[model samples]
Structures are given as C-alpha cells and as structure tokens.
Target: MKWGENVKKEIGQKIKELRLAKELTLKDLSEKADLSIGFLSQVERGMASLTVASLEKIAQVLEVDLAFFFTLPQKHEANIMRSYGQEVFSVEESKYFYRLASDLEGKSLEPVLIHLLPNQGREEISPYSHQGEEFVYVLEGILTVFMGDEEYKLNPGDSMHIFSSLPHEWANFTKKLVKVLCVRTPGIFQGDKG
Candidate 1:
C-alpha cells in the first residue's frame, strides 16, 4: 500500500481500538462526532480518509488528543537526528507531506518539516483548530496561509506565529514547491495523561 493509505489504515485501527476501549459503538461515536454512521464505519475500516477538521471532531468525541493518530509505537530519543530520506507522511488528502523533526517525548514543542507541492492547497479541506501555539517559517518558495478572515503570503526567510485555537489553512500558489518548518507548542503527539 502507499504511504498515505498505510498511515490511514493504522490511524483507523487506532481509532477503532480507542473507541472499543471506551465502550463506544460505531453509532455512539458517530453521534458524538456529529458524523454519519456510514462515514464513521468507512473510516474505521480504513476505506475512507479524513481531513484534520474531521479528525479533530472525532478526537474530541473520543476524548483523545488529535496527535494520538500520528504517533508511532517505537521509542523516541531525547537527542535525535534524522538523516536525509527520513520517513514522511501525508495529512490525508491535503496534498502536503510532513516529517517529524523532534523526538523529545512529552516535550512542550513539536517541530515538523512540511512540504507543499505546487497548486496543492488546504482550501479544499476544512480548516482545523486546536489548543496551543504555532510558528511557521518558510524555508523555500512561497506559502499562502489563511487564518480566520485574513490571508498572509509568506516567502522564504519569512515566519509567522499565532495561537493555534484560531481556524487556519494553507496552500502553495506558486509553481515551485514550498517547504516550511513548523513548530507547535504543547506537544500534540505526547501520550495522554488522562
């Protein structure tokens, strides 16, 4: 299977496992998530992909962090260095690829290298919001960020910081590829304390 498909399958399995552990049936979860039963069932079976907004809704309904679906089961190191050709994953149908840049478990920050292809943008997907803060530094090409009612065009060497609670989305309008370094606070991938 492709990377996107494999990742989706794994995430779907995790969601199903968590739901069962919480003693919630598919119908129950669908009701809480404000999604249809058929859609939820398809997601659980890995036959469908979900956007970050949809995943956030399901995460809220399941009482789990949104990052729970992204973390791997392997141990993370305190001092980490990933060489070239490191693993990268897609954010469902977003057409963006990201590779985790930090390995400090439970750390306050999560850094990722995000690659946005030309003409591929988040406008097709719903914007998502979460608790914390985010800093994005454009490494190459240009990035168009949509936050609430405003839009910001960022070029290489430009950066923006914002509270993540606001609805946000991004896209690359340039013909060239866009690479950004994004750092977020509150460790979204950290294990649940609850």
Candidate 2:
C-alpha cells in the first residue's frame, strides 16, 4: 500500500477501535463529532479522505489525542535516544518534518523535534488535538502556532505550554528555517507505562 493510503487505513482502524472500545455506536460518534454518519462510516472504512479539521473533531469526541492515531505500536529497548542515526520522519498528510526525540517504549512523555520549512502554511500542516499537555520550546528561527484559531509567534528561546485538547496547527511563514522541541503526554499508547 502507498504510504498515504496505508496511513489512512491505519488511522481509520484506530478510530474504529477507539469508538467501539468506548461503547459508542456510529450514530453516537457522528452526532458528537458533528459529522454525518455516512461520512464517518466511509472514513472508518478507509474509503474517504479525512481532513485535519474533521479528524480533530472526531479525536475530540473519541477522547484521544491526535498522536494516538499516528502512533504505531513499537517496542523500543534502548532508553538513550541519540540524535545521530535517528531517522527523520513525517506524516504524509503534513509537510512538517519530525524526529522522535524520546523513543523508550511505554514512556509517559514523548519528545519530538519538529522542523518547518520556510514559507510553509497551515494548509501544509496537520491539525492536532489530544487530551494531554504539551511543552514546546523554539530552538531555531520563528515558529507560528495556531491553537484553536489563536495565533502566536515564537522565536529562539521562547517556550509555551499547550493544552493538547485544542485543535492546533503550526506554520513557518518566513524565509528562515524553523525548528522546535516539543514534549507531550499520553504517547506510546500500547506499551507498559514508565
């Protein structure tokens, strides 16, 4: 399967599982998410494209952070996560780049390095929603954050604590590169907690 399609199917499955685990019927979820049942069914079946906004609504209704959908079950043995040899990865739906900073399986905290290229816009980024808290520190250049329609700009050495339940997006609408260190909770969903 193609990366985008595969990822969509994975996310669809996760959504379905969460909804069922919560004992919510399709109609219940559709109403709570303010989405049509047919549309939600199509998404769960991986037969439709899911926009970030729509996903945020569903995630909010499902009571899971956006990271829960993107995370695959991986068991990591090493506790020390070195920058060297760490592969740069990304969600296909979003143009932003990412590097996993904390890889210990089942850890309470998940740290990530986010890189936004120059001139990137909200359309190129994915919206995020979760029930966790996030701490972000600007490492390089300027980072533009949109938290539930509130816009904020952060420069080097600037930091912010974000309530993850709010739908959020990040952009770098400048000529310079942007890098940020982000740490959040409720990650590593299927592993033994630390």
Candidate 3:
C-alpha cells in the first residue's frame, strides 16, 4: 500500500481504538482531541488525513504516545537494529524522503534515517520543539542544521546534538542526497518511555 494510504488507515484504527478504550462517545472524544466532531469522525472513518500536529494532539488527549499510532504490535527484543536490507519503512515521494530508523515498539528513542534529495531544500523556518534530546549524524553529503538562531554546516561523519526543547530544522546544501541519522531520545510518543 502507499505510505500515505497505510498511514491514514492506521491512524483511523488507532483513533477508534483509543476512543473505545476511553469509553468516550464521538462528541466526548472530539472535545478532548480539540477537533471538530465531524472532522474527527472522518478521520476515524479513514476518510481524512491527520496532520502530525493533529495526531499529536489526539494522542495527548488519549493519554497515549503519538508513536503509538505508528507502532505495529509485535514481540521482540529491545534495542534491536535491523540491517540495511531489513528496513521496514522507506518511502520516496516526489518532494521528500522518509525512513524509520528504529522499530516503534518499547522504544526510548525515535530514530529517523532520512535522505533529503537536492532541490527539495527548505528555507530557514522557525525551530520546532518537542520533548527530549536530538542527535543527528551526517552520513553523506552536506547539510545545514539549524538550532534556534545558530546554523551549522555538517559534512559526512559530522554530528550535532541538542535538546529537543530547542527549535531546529535542516537543509540540504549539496547537489547530492543528504543522508542523516537522527536520534530523538525519550521518544516522541508518550508510551515510549524507557
């Protein structure tokens, strides 16, 4: 399935489960999620896309982790690493690229191995803050990393580490793909505490 489609379906299912688990009516859950009843209904019906911000808000209201929406139920050892050929999430759309660097189960960190294609670089946007610490190791090409007002240029083998409470963004500065290994500690999802 397409990544977007799969995500949408999973989001719907997760939302439904959370609502049921909380024993909430549609109106009650909508009020808690701070979303319109109709909109939340559509999302639960697999008829809408939940933005990352929206998903986070819903997770907050549900007393769950945002990553809870991404995890697939499974029994596995902790801190496991999959080889290059074993990656479970990799998607290339026209404008961006994404990959999951770690399995979303009993995790203390959320690692995203990303490759930003040239020509898709974004401007210096405001920093976005979350809950923990962030570390990024550049694997290939050049990348511009922004930590609040400071901007650092990172090349292959270089790394940047900062508190997640600080705002940050990145840009691809080379013609080639900019690959980065990003690790966010304390995980972005609530249940990811470890």
Which candidate number maximizes TM-score?
1
- Candidate 2: worst 10 consecutive residues by lDDT? 185-194
Per-prediction TM-score to the true structure, in the order listed: 0.79, 0.63, 0.62
Clash count for candidate 1 is 0
Error of 3 at 38 (Å): 8.8
lDDT of 1 by residue, 129-190 (tens): 77788999999998888899888899999999989889987787788988999887764455
Residues 1-194, model 2: lDDT tens digits: 12377677888899999999999999999999888999889889887766556776787788765567775434343675555545554443334444464454546777777676677655665666756778989999988888886788889999998777888877788988788888867542322132
Model 2 vs. true fold: TM:
0.63
Residue pairs in steric clash, candidate 1? none
CA-RMSD of model 1: 3.1
Better of 2 and 3 by lDDT: 2
For residue 42, what is the lDDT in candidate 1? Answer: 86
lDDT for model 3: 0.68
Model 2 CA deviation exceeding 4 Å by range: 1-3, 13-26, 36-42, 45-77, 84-92, 95-106, 117-130, 147-149, 163-168, 174-177, 188-194
Best by lDDT: 1
